[model samples]
Every structure is written in C-alpha cells, then in structure tokens.
Target: MTSVNDQTQIEQETGNTEGESKDSVKQEKEMKPEESNANSPTELSKLTKIVKHSKPEQPLGFDGFKKQYYRYASKFGTTLNLLVVGGSSLGKTTFVNSLIQGSLTGKKTAKTSDFMQHRLRMTDGDINFNLTILDTPGFGEKCDNSNCWKPLANILVQRLNAYFENEIKACRQLPIVDTRIHGCLFFINPTGHMLDPLELYVMKRIDRFVNIIPVIAKADMLTPEECARFKRNIIKDLQHEHIQFFHEPGKSIEGINYGMPEPFALIGATKGMQSDSKNAIRGREYPWGVINIDDPQHSDFCAFRNFLLYTHAEALIEKTHKVIYDALRTERLNKLKSQPNGFYTSSKKLVEEYMKAELGRVERSLRQTVQDKLQEKENLLAYTEKQLEAKHKEYEESLINRCNELKSQKQSLENLVRSDKTKKHSIFFK
Candidate 1:
C-alpha cells in the first residue's frame, strides 16, 4: 500500500479520469444552447408559416350566389299574402294575369264567386319566394251590400285565430307559415265622382286590419280631366271619412304634388294592342285613341305595381306582423286574462270538453294498438295449436303401426311353437 509504483499508478488513473470529465463538460457546454432551443418555443415559431388574409376581390359565381341566397331565404321564410277585394266585373283576374306575366294557373273566376286562393313562385335575382293571392270575387256585388265585408273580416279573424292557436301550442312548429292578409288591394269603380257609401263602409271597416290600397279600376273609361277630378274627390272623401290607406307616414308629403296621393288610378288589360307608333302596348284601344296602362302620364298602374311588388313590399309585410297581427294577438291574450267569472267558467268548460275529446281520441288509438297486438298473438297461438295437433296425430299413427307389427311377430312365434310340437310328437311315435 505504501509502494511508490502503486502511488504513481493511482495518480495516473486519477489524471485520466479528470481529463475524461473535462472533455464531457466541454461537449455538454457546446449542446447547452441547442437544449435550451429545444425546450423553448423558438423552433416551433420558425416552422410555422404566416399567411395574410383579405376579403375576396372577385364576386361569387351564380351557383355560389344562389347558395348564399337560399341561406338567406332559410333564415327568413318568404311567403307573401295579398287579398284582392272588388265588386263584379272589376277585371281583378285580368290585373293579376297582367301583373304576373301570364303565369296564373287558376281558372278564371265568375262574377259570383267565393274566396279562392292561388299560389305562384316569384323570383328576384337569386332569391325566390311564394306569392299567395286571395280573391274575394262577390264582395260588394250583392244588392244588399250591408253584410259583404263580414265574410272577409271573419276570414281574416279566422286566420289570425289559427296562427294564434299555433303560436300558443305546447310544441309549436318551426317557422310558422303566415297566412294572414298582408295587403288588401281594394278596386274602386271609375265613376268619375267620389267613393260610394258601400266602398267607404268596407274600407273603413277593414282598413284597421290590413294595408288597404284603393285603386280606381277601368280608368280608361274616364277622360284625363275627369280622372284627375275623380282622384281629387276620392282623396278628399277618404280624408274626410278618416279612412287609413297604405301611405308611408313620418315621411315628407312633398311627393303628393309630384304624383297623385293615396288612391291610385289603374287600368288593367291582359291583351296587348299596338299603338299609333306600331309599338305593342298594354292598354285599351278606344275609338278615340290608345291609353297605355304602363305610362305614368296615362295611368298610375306602373307606379302602383312598383309600389306593391317592389318598393313597399317589405313594408306591408312588416306592418302586418308588427302592427296588425301583434295588436290582435295582444288583444286576445288580454281578453283571456280579463275574463269575468261566468266567461271564465264557460271557457274552462270548453277547454275541459276539448281535453276530454282529445283524451278519448288518444285512448281509442291506444286501444286499437293493443287490439292489433292481441290479434297478432291470437293468430300465432292458433298456428302453434294447429302444428301441435298435427304432430300429435302423426305420433299416435306411428305408435299404432309399431304395435301392430309387434302383434304379428307374437302370432308368428306362436305358429312356430305349434309346428315344432307337432313334429316332436311324430318323431316319438316313429
């Protein structure tokens, strides 16, 4: 242990170990920065690529536009309802045909007709909607026109009641199809005077419920001077009677001087006749001259059409829901809430009756379902019994055949024994 050579070897070994440790330290120092980078997010940041996004400069194609349009249509259900009210021979069908460009599918209604509804798919660019036109053919045409507006009002109220019932249902359908009258186009006769008593009564009664747009039908029958005077008198009469028409209030009345206000003068013609200039025009070719229906100077048909179909279309729909429909709904709810004891009792009795009927229906359905299941089970049981009876008969026949075979074997054995005995006796005698 005290040898100089041993001491020298130990010192050499120690020196070698120290030198190897120093080399490892130097290598670890060189990898320190790389290890730090691996632990940090710097490497990930370097690998990521950055992109600059911007709005598309080019417009979408027709297909993409249609997709977007349908998306919008889905967001907002599009169904337009229009109520047309007029007397007999007012050319309501002709006006509808002309407006829709010969796309009406319903048969032409007669002078005395009931409430008829027609549907058409209207398209504007990529957006599409359903247009429902309701025609009241015999309105105000009766000799006793006193109760003419009652049917129309009752129909309107019925639709509102149906919508209200659906709204208050326990489970309501998504996106209720609105069948309420959004607008009423009331056609007035071109008598070149003022509004008749019947017309005033109907307008005043229904104006609060719907957007009324009074149009003077067959304006071609009246001269220009007569038309202007009639329009003025009609406006004065409407204002005097406090009748509400579809005029955008809160807006300036400056357009009144520029164009006829409130009541519109219209001439409806389905057939086209050539003008003096040989141009095809939609108007009446009278003995004196041709009156172009689309001309602003000749008639207000173009302005009224634009107002109804394009400009104020959304307004009419919005007002119907926001003003008329909502008011009716609120009133109904209030009535239900404010009912007295007797009325409440009656209503409760009615509700009980309805619930009893509904419960009876449900019970009948459930009983039918149970009866059907029982019948199925009975049929299966009958089939099983038949199979069991057939198998039992087959087993009994098989047992009977086996028993007969065994009896024949026994008889054969007896016959053999008798023969053997007889042979033995003969042998003994011999």
Candidate 2:
C-alpha cells in the first residue's frame, strides 16, 4: 500500500511540472508575435512606402488648359493684332492661311492693282487674333516703282490720325479696339541677292510706325550655300541703310541664330504627301527625296513662327503703344501748336478743337485732384471730431467722480467733528 501511494504522488508531481512547461512554451509563442511586430518598420515608414507607390492626380490636359487661358484673357480684355504686309505671289496669302490654320480654298487676300487691306479674325487655342493683311499689289511689278511705297505709308499715317482723332473726342468707346498696325511682315523674293529698291523703300517708310520682320520668301528655291550668302548680303544691306528689324532692347538675344541674321529664310507649302517613313511633309516633290517645310535644316519657317507668335508678340504691342503711338501723338500736338491761327481755316478749326479737348482733359484732372484732397481732409476732420468728443466725455466723467469724492469727504469730516464734540462732552461729564 505504501508503494502504490508513492507512485500516485510521483505521477501528480510530473503532471504539474509538464503543465507548467507547456504554459511557459505557449507564453513564449504569444510573445514572439509581439517581438516580431516591434522589430518591423515604423508606421511612418509604411506610410512613406504607400505614398511612393501610389499614383498622383493628373494635371489638366490641353483642352482644359486652353479654356482656362481663354477665361483669363476675356476677363482681362487682351487681343493680338497682326498685320501681314508683302507683295503679291510671294507666298503672303499662303502664309496667312497657314497662320490661321484654315482650309479656305481659293480665299486669297484682295489682289487688286492697287494696295488694299483685308480684314480677318482668327482664334487659335485660347488666343483671339485680329489679323489684317495689307496687300500691296504691283509694288515691284511696275517699271517705275518710284513712289510705290506711298500708299502703304499713307495707310499707316491714316491709322495714326484716326487714333489721335478718337483720343481728342469727348465721348469714346471703352478699351478702344486698337486698329493700328502692330507688326508688318515684309517678304523679300529669294533672289540670293540684296534687298530690292522697292523693299528698302517700303521698309524705311514704315519701320518707324510698325515692327517690320523681313522674310526671305520661297527659300526652298535657293540651295543651302546660296541661302547663307543671301542672308549675309541682306544683313549687310540693312545695316548700311540703317534699317531696324523687330528687336526688343534690354532683352536677351541668345539662342536665336536663324532669326538674328534679320531676314528669316522661309518656305510656305500648302500641300503634303506621306513619305516612306510615314511622315507627312508639307513640301514640293522632286526627283530626289522630300523637303519638309518645318524642318530647320530645310528652312527657317519654324524659327520665324516662334519669333512671331511666342517671343515678340507682347513686345510688339508694347512698342506700338509706348514708342510709335506716343511719338506720333507728340508730333501731332507740336504741329497743332506751330500752325498759324488765321491761315488754313479748316486746319485751324481742327487744331482749335484738339486744343479745347486738351484743355477740358486738364480741367477735369485738376477738378478730380481737388475733390480727392477735399475728401481726405473731410475724413481727417471727422476722425479728429470723434476723438475730441470721446475725450470730452472722459473729462466730464472724471470731473463728476471727483465732485462726488469731495462731497463724501465733506460729510465724513462733519461726522468726525460731531463725534469729537460728543467725546469731549462725555469726558467733561465724567
């Protein structure tokens, strides 16, 4: 019996020991998961990983960008006016069509024997452009092109005069739609020689009033060597004649090689065909391979395009306003001042009208200035009056408080005197 009792005791001890070992193993296993979590990357690191892998929201596409630009332009009231001036059959019409990116078949600038202006409005992407192509027909075509440039000169002067007249008028439209020629693109025939007399004459006459950009028309007619020589000659001639092309002062002239030589060699092609490389080139087909109009090696059309539309559009407009138009206005005013009073009766009346308008403008300005000063003074006086009123109220309140304190002191003094008398009487009675 003793041996059996000892065996039961041993079995209970072993079972308890085994259960403790098992519990310790299970605890270690649970703790292992927590240890692993602690060893892993931090929460911030995991968030960074997610951010690096996730796709960001895309930006607005071309159409959306154009609409946004248009909205801003409309709100600000801005427009580009381009005037294309070139002789007939010099790809002027073709160039205009290309600029507007239209397929108006057989729609050319009015090709009259005389100089004429054709008006067309075009909108590309977000930009709205008012295009005026001044076609000078029979310019160099005549045998005696002596005074051929006079018509164009007259047109520019007429525009200036009209603008001046509008300025002198009492009532005028708001944000006046400026019709003055901002830019003139003069086309030179690709003769691989210097500029013709007619081009030089026209350029000299209009360069002061407008920004002239010389173009070597039909550049593909000349070879590369010939084109280079032609460009050099044109530059030399322009420098000798003291003619100025479109160039902005105080602006960097870097990275514009093809345009710096002055007359940009250009080619305009309205037709195109697919080549073996599956590229549609707008060029004339020869026995050899194709010559792309946009290819820089072939022509400077791309360079000229960038210069016209991107680099100098705003500068041209600014120059016209500040330099050309302002100078013209000053000259007109000076002329009006110099004219005799009695002679040229119509001229005298016009000058008188202009002077009257000027006087009215000055009077209105002076009146406005006086009114503004008076308003400022009134505001200052009102502020001072308010301050004075507030100070007066404070002073009155302080005076009333002091008066009350004095009255209280007087009553207290009277009471004290009566108490002293009472004390004295009590002492006497005692």
Among all candidates shown, the one with the greatest TM-score: 1
Off by over 4 Å in 2: 1-72, 104-127, 249-261, 340-430
Residue-level lDDT of model 1, residues 1-430, one tens digit each, is: 2233443354354332233333322221223444446655554333332211122233324347667767887656477788888777887877766666663333453454677788888777656767888877746656767557766766676666667777877899867878888898888888998888888988876787788878888887789889889988988898899998776643434453323265777877766778879987877666788778888998888888777766677788998889988987787678677887514323334334544654576569779999999999999999999999999999999999999999999999999999999999999999
Q: How far is 411's C-alpha from truth in model 2 (Å)?
A: 99
Q: Quick one: how many clashes does candidate 1 have?
A: 0
lDDT of 2 by residue, 184-218 (tens): 78888888978887788778867777777778888
Q: After superposition, how far is residue 221 of candidate 1 from its true place, in Å?
A: 1.9
What local lDDT score does residue 154 receive in model 2, on the 0 to 100 scale? 62
TM-score of each: 0.58, 0.57
lDDT of 1: 0.72
The models' CA-based lDDT, in order, is: 0.72, 0.67
- Candidate 2, residue 222: how far the Cα is off, in Å: 1.7
Task: List candidate 1 stretches off by more than 4 Å.
Answer: 1-71, 74-77, 103-109, 250-260, 340-430
